[model samples]
Target chain A: MDAARFRIRRAAGGIDADAKIINRATLSFVLALLGFGFWKSGFDPTVVWRGLLVIVREPDILINDYVALAGLGPAFVNAGLLALAAWGLLRVTGVLISGPALAAIFTVAGFSLFGKNPFNVWPIVVGVMIFTWVERRPFKDNIIVALFGTALAPIVSEFAFGIGIASPWNLLAGVVAGLAAGFFLTPVARGALDFTRGYNLYNIGFAAGFVGTVTMSALRAFNVPLSGGFAWAENGPDEILPFLALYFASMIVIGLVEDEDALPNLLDLLRTSGRLVSDYPRSFGIGATLLNMGLMGFTGSLLALAAGCDWNGPVVGGIFTLVGFSAFGKHPLNALPPMLGVMAAASLTPYGLEAPGSQLALLFSATLAPIAGAYGPVAGFIAGLLHLTLVHNVGHLHGGLDLYNNGFSGGMVAGIMVPMLDWIRERRRHEP
Target chain B: MNLDATQLMRCGDELAKYLYLRGSRRVRISYDFGEERSFCAISAPDYLLDEAERTRILKVFSGPIQPEIASYYGALAGRRRDGAEIELLGTMAELEDLMVTEGGGTQIVLSRREAEYFGKRKKR
Candidate 1:
């Protein structure tokens, strides 16, 4: 009995050690992003401050790249700071930084380059906090949801600055709206999962889309004039490409340094369908999880470059999101089919391969990688094709208020496909 | 290791559902409590699971406990048809036993301990 107890204790210790490594790696990435940002701005405090002001004041709707609006330095700084704050919140709440936590933090950082900002994301988080208080649950329980709930950060910015509202009233309205969105997000997101049945990895995105749609409808009814536009950074691939290569390569190196069996473990990981709650850090250890993340990041980058797409803000944001989710429900094998489907759609449709929207669709379509993982690659390709067709049109529903537009679209695609695929499989099984 | 009543019930529910899908018409679940540990044992007589299926079940049930993932997705436990929720169950409780009975039946025991439970509670 003592030997059995000791074995259990030793196993628990191993899990703890892996968790610590993941936490450290995530923190190191955050610091590197911060240092890179400062270096890019030549350590000019004035430039960073000015750029940050521009980022905060902008109506950060869909296609609004902070890199273009405020330059590369402030954009990176904003992302790094937001991610750091998110990581700090998890630590303070006594939440273990696991695979999902890593995904949420990296996602917060990634989207900050395009939509999320320090000023606008807090209201929604505070709202989630309020929710936990109401439910009498610990804040740590819903911290991941709070981080992902920032998908609606643009709602705050749009309400505060875009609707032509004047002064403090606009800011007040934005805060109230953000709080309301966050308050309902948890319950709605939980319910939303049933709609997709865990096929769509970004469950919060689907819920936020519903919230954003209703909010947009209300704004439209009030005769609010919402003008849509796009802001993409066209230059800087020379710098961005090398930086990404080094960052992703470092992840692989770290993985190899941490674990001797990372390669075999990663192969084992790729064999399983990346369904929700597929916590790779726990299943394959943090070492293999990190290796998968780096490989997925490189796959996304190579896909964009091969398609003749420029390395822009949204493009980088898309790749970053892919990297983050790699530890959760994505890998190169499962993700590639959907991405290829998006690339094929771009080639066939009027949306050219180099188009910003098409490039993003290619990367974000990995949200449906579980489809390919569960079904076959052919089904995944179909999902990706459908995602491209629908994602372009759904933004008008939310009026670009949701940053995870691909998630919203992926939910619809999954909802449509899963039932039919199940029926087909059932019929085939019975035919024998 | 000491799960609340609700969590323990969920563990039983997930096991029952998993067994039901695998052709077990009746599942017997019993609980045991002690000062140091608590356990739930789910048993089915003359179970028909093959070696491959048994291996897969054991692998998933023996996976590490991930409380964070459980907190976010626990609501879906026992509601999924693809056995994914069983994965979530593995994240909440430890597998204690997967043994064959004299009648060629299967009994699986899941356990939680007071020490680890209080340790986590203190960390929280």
Candidate 2:
């Protein structure tokens, strides 16, 4: 019956309250993929299933393992799920969720376990929802803003738990701040676009910079403690790799079920800018998009593996994100140079070419795929080199306040590099 | 105003349909600037455009607004054009200019600068 309901290309707006049906199907299929990975990792299917069941029922009991698994698996799952949530929000509201919105959701979600969570994120969502009501436009219309708008999720969460405020005061101030953040987000996003121009993709990073700046100020004015974070991971490739396989496999399958012709559409996807409003589902159908996604995922995953980077939580999240953006703008044609440049730079420097930090630099820096897409391969290589350097060091500028370090770094890289690149090109043109 | 002839006529017809939908029957338009600036304007009675009807007309101008435009509208809604003296409000100049260009059943008048300046703003 569930299969009957969501017959791939046969239905529109699927994933309804027929939750059990899809849930069962998704769960079974997901677990099957999981089982294959665990088997490959030498775990019996029965044992893996029992462990996962316990993991699901009591997340805190397996909090250590679950968080470890979540840190890696959830990046993709969160981004994919965030996308589905956007899709659902769009389907229900008739608004087209913007690319920036999708990226924002993924970015914030990737940071959630440590910094953001369902509790903190809700206020931001609620705030944005209120703005939609007042504007007389369906919430979906501002999809990009709504999604990218979640950078403030940390503010919400920090307000909820970080401060020494009373529980009631904490929740109240936290939620109110989020709503105010949401209310002002649309206009602020619109207002800030000009300050940097289109060179920066993470306009929300720019928005978040302002937000975090103001938030830090407000927190400072009052007596509130908002500072510091810890790196939490128990580096284990054996456990993490299987989880990565399951998540990517599920995405590939979902994409496959939807694409009618997997082959040609994969080719066509490369031709697109992968910018906002890129509806690969509509343009290429399910099968092709899936194929492309799978290939991209594999390629990105392999890059992480070959780089010998640890397959812990954050790195996996970064890899999943790079692969997902293949549809948006991170095509192999464009993405390779930055990864190559970064690797080249790492190999020569004190940085270990095969290190997690190095891989993280290369992976997240792929967000500047447009440099490759916009300029020639040379510029992209340069952009990647520039990104690799800046991304590693830029976190401190925001005081790790802006969680989309790639975006924050991407903005700076694109902002500084593109103009200089253009000047150089112009000089070359003017020369004999 | 500098649009190709067919594009101009097509724009005119859309204005006519919009005016017709809003219950107007006759209209005229004039341009004060050069051929670059010379164009038509559509005039219709106020609120003669019901909500849906008004929206249909508004969609044409929303076009591919870059973030700059989106932000400009966000911040400058009620402020005049950047270099002009009119000190118009919000996106009023844009809304008015769009009406003038859709020249089938209405008349619109723009100052010399506005006549030449309607579509000048790009992404940056």
Candidate 3:
């Protein structure tokens, strides 16, 4: 059965005991993570409110570095609130709480740690809603895509206040840009899928990257200097380390509580190629999916610590994204190869291993996990190497407008590599 | 408990009905009944046996049957460029020797006694 049908059946009183427990546990875990961030930020809701004002008023173009603008406490609080807002939207929409939805929610929260805030993310969201209204379709149809589509949200922030124009004109231009981005996203994302054929998990990211590129190019032609911005926080990892451990450990405990076969099921999930359309919640049950996500998060945190990287907003955001994707199409086996490949490139190239850009790339490299899953580890390593090399250069195309820069690079790498792998597999099958 | 000709026909009709409801089209079932065991071949264009339908059929076949006289074992055999072949084995006793393929399609050869079941029998 499809996810929609499964949800219907669940609602019709045939609820699986394991599924019920797992759903509650997953929601609780997210709420807890957010609460911890708030607590760590001294529980000052007013500070977060002020920080959010600062986040919105500024031009949040690519690499704007939210952590640098807002203090760590406020930035984390903004992320937490944004995640909660996404959760609330799911509730209001009466959408089934599934692995995919969880992934979307965590992604919002993760990106909130960096580029997304309640203010800028919503215009793109409303723009998507406008698309659905004009198309006369249910909002649920594009809810997931709309949330992920906020990769272009930076365009809204940049156009709104960054451009030197009078009040009404700047605001009008910003709204128009946001509406256009959201409107074009559906068709562009759908078309881009054929290019990757479901190999690159961040299909929307790739689409947004292209959209961002074209939009940025158009604006730049008129002499709008789209500055490529980047900054990282220099916070010590003292509190962040313990928080990461607890957050991931809680996920493991919740998984164990929800399912008896979580360990074996998680291992089974790992055996899959982590391809698109692989929903762990449906296949291995929600409990095992949560287990895999917890493990993935822990693994990401460990890698960051080993590289001597701080747990800043972007780094945490990247880790959150990797962990969230584990529910949809990521596993330890597939994710590790690309990450290690990035680390290798960092060491060999002029980039320092602990550089912010390299660390961000290392975490985002999980976007190419499908290659590792489908091919062997060696192929995965090659894809990762290619991704790191291309990622730094691709930013110039959009001038840092596309937030998921690694995703754009991953799509290109997969487009080039998967067909070759398919050809080789066919030939080997025919040989001898 | 060997099935009579009428019982054999009923089994085929019932199985075909099950497959048809689950999206299989142009299903063809060929059968041969011996004194002790029976052989049946069920083939349809591979498109009909999507992941969901395949899983459904396996569940239905393995599920308990009232007044059980025989147990069914299924293996996927030949594949057309378009679809695949599914074979079902019904017996009063289970086979001791089972050949397993890790990644290849499952194939179970018909015995000489059941050779007539080899040919396709189109259903109306």
Best model per lDDT? 1
Model 2, runs deviating above 4 Å: A1-87, A96-114, A133-136, A195-199, A217-224, A246-261, A273-279, A347-358, A427-432, B1-124
The per-model DockQ list reads: 0.24, 0.05, 0.02
Q: Rate the local accuracy (lDDT) of all candidates.
A: 0.82, 0.51, 0.68
- Winner on TM-score between 1 and 3 is 1
lDDT of 1 by residue, B2-86 (tens): 2234465678888888788777887899987655666899998858555655665576665566555665677667666655356
Candidate number 3, chain A TM-score: 0.93
Error of 3 at A161 (Å): 1.6
lDDT of 3 by residue, B1-124 (tens): 2223333444455445545555656667676666435555444442234445444334323212211111100111111111121212221112222222443222222211211121243111
Q: What number of backbone clashes does candidate 2 have, counting pairs of residues 3 or more apart or in separate chains? A: 19
**Per-residue lDDT of model 3, residues A1-432, tens digit only:** 221211111112222554466457656756766677577657887776787788777667666667788877777777778777777776676555555667777788888877877767887888887876554445655677788888888887788777776797987777788888988887687677767766687877888899999998998899886534566787777867688778888888887776677777676777777766455665566668878988999999989888878678888888889888988889999999999999999888988677777888999998889889878899999998988888878988987777888888889998899889888988998999
- Which candidate tops DockQ? 1
Residue A48 displacement (Å), model 1: 1.1
TM-score pick, better of 1 and 2: 1
Model 3 misplaced stretches (Cα beyond 4 Å): A1-23, B1-53, B56-124
Q: What is the TM-score of each predicted model, taking all chains together?
A: 0.90, 0.63, 0.77
Which DockQ-derived CAPRI band holds candidate 1? Answer: acceptable
Two-chain complex of model 1, DockQ on C-alpha atoms against the true structure = 0.24
Residue A87, model 3: Cα distance from true site in angstroms: 1.5
